[model samples]
Target chain A: MDIRTLCLGILALGDATGYEIKKMVAEGSFSFFSEASYGSIYPALTKLTTEGLIECRQESQSNRPDKKIYSLTEAGRAALEDSLAKDPRPDKNRSEFLASLLFAEAVAPERINSLVQDRITSHKRQIDALKLMRAEEDSPVGQFVLDYGIQVQQAAYDFLIANKGRIVTKL
Target chain B: MDIRTLCLGILALGDATGYEIKKMVAEGSFSFFSEASYGSIYPALTKLTTEGLIECRQESQSNRPDKKIYSLTEAGRAALEDSLAKDPRPDKNRSEFLASLLFAEAVAPERINSLVQDRITSHKRQIDALKLMRAEEDSPVGQFVLDYGIQVQQAAYDFLIANKGRIVTKL
Candidate 1:
């Protein structure tokens, strides 16, 4: 998804700073499905403001950079709706773990082991976080997306644990 | 997964024309994980050739554009391995379906219903394709990634089928 469209959707929920937008993407159940870095988010916000799809207001902060609170304009809301109406691009799974495993023969056994262990740990944490967010969901969309995250993460964790030895031994 | 790294990985398999490379990406198991347009692939191939990471040989063809088949060099292989050693970016799922469902209230009831049905149908097809690919897998990495795809796609399909009514009716 375009970052501009994503920013509009998040702002529709209420006002937020770029940091808050990044935070929401990182910690929210939505994070399971998507993420945005400040690298992309700040530039997206600037572009959206230029295109007049969103409005921002400055707020002074103590001992920190001033926050730019962003909100969706009517145009932004309409654009988001239009984006929704269009066909969604297929979901992609570009795991570095998978890519590395394709060349496992060249990697040190310990390195493959560490990578597998890291993936298991990460998957477990994501599953836990998704479960936690799911506990509070009142929206169908939230519930559905959260459940999707839990299912995929659990499957991944199980695969990692079950196959770790195969990969590690081969390295 | 940067496109440049992805291209290097493909070349690791064998030599192929840029057009052939695009076909491999679109038709192979990698289809679910990544994509590139001819626009990007041609330019990337030229740059890689100039940088000495890859070597290309031109082959004359009948009634078609001459093909430039690219093969990875020792340096290219080293670069690819280096990229693999680095932390791979997590998989991203930018689902406009979920985004649209978030605003189910604004969409027409029929439109929401149609979208849900279309998504479920499309997911089912993808799951079937993943299963077929799984049947043809020969390596551990292929087996692992195929399993991952099947599990994720099945979970998504099940969720959409089970929750379509709850979401669409809210429109």
Candidate 2:
């Protein structure tokens, strides 16, 4: 998704500093489905403010840079709703582990097993995190997103566990 | 993974035109996990050739643009192996559908169902494609990747079919 739309959505939740916006975009509830670096987030926020979809004010802070707080305008809320109503853009998922495994024959057999093992360990952590998040989410939308993450990750972990033997020993 | 390493891996498969390389990268094995656009691929190929990792030979076609076929050199093979042996980068996956669904309350009740139904139908097509691909893949690495795609898509399809109504009705 465009960082502009995402910034509007975040500000709609509540007022936030640019730092908070970047943090939430990277690691919050919607992190799995959306992402933006500070480079992108600051520019997006600036543009949204210029377009009047959002408004920001400055706050003085001790021993730190001044915080710029942002909130969604009424127009921003409508824009977000309109965006959600439209057809979503196609997904673009990146998995370097899968890419490496595709070239498994070139590596030592143990390394293939190692990679799969590492994936399972990391993925399990994600599934557990999602499970906890799902438990706390009362909104159907939040639940739906959490369930999606859980299902996909669980499937990956299951596949690796069930099939690793077949591939690992053969190489 | 970086496009340069990915181009090396694609060339390791066999000699392929830049057009063919992009197709395979976007649609072939590991596609769901790794991606590169023609914008990145051409540069990657050029740089690989310059670095002595890949060699390209021009093929004159009768009525089409002259094709450049890329092949992996011994150094390229070693580089790919070395890459595989290293820890894979963390995955960054985007699901625009899931992102849209996260705002289900903001959208009309019926549109939520519509979005989910579209997602389920499209996801099933991917599951079917992966199944067909898996059946033909004899290599262990190829089979692993296909199975990964199938398992995840299948899990998603199942979840949507079973739980979508509960979420849809409440929205």
The best candidate by lDDT is 2
Instruction: Considering the two chains of model 1, state its CAPRI-style docking category.
Output: acceptable
Which candidate gets the maximum DockQ versus the true structure? 2
| Candidate 1 C-alpha lDDT tens digits along A72-117 | 8888888877777787776666666666555443433346676777
Q: Which stretches of candidate 1 lie over 4 Å from their true place?
A: A37-76, A105-114, A136-140, A163-171, B105-112, B163-171
**C-alpha displacement of B102 in model 1, angstroms?**
1.8
Q: Give a tens-digit lDDT track for model 2, residues B3-97.
A: 88877776766688888878886777666777778998888788889999988889899999898888889888888888887899778878778
Q: Each model's TM-score, in the order given?
A: 0.82, 0.92
> Which residue pairs collide in model 1, if any?
none
Tell me the chain A TM-score of model 2. Answer: 0.86
Off by over 4 Å in 2: A58-63, A107-110, B107-110
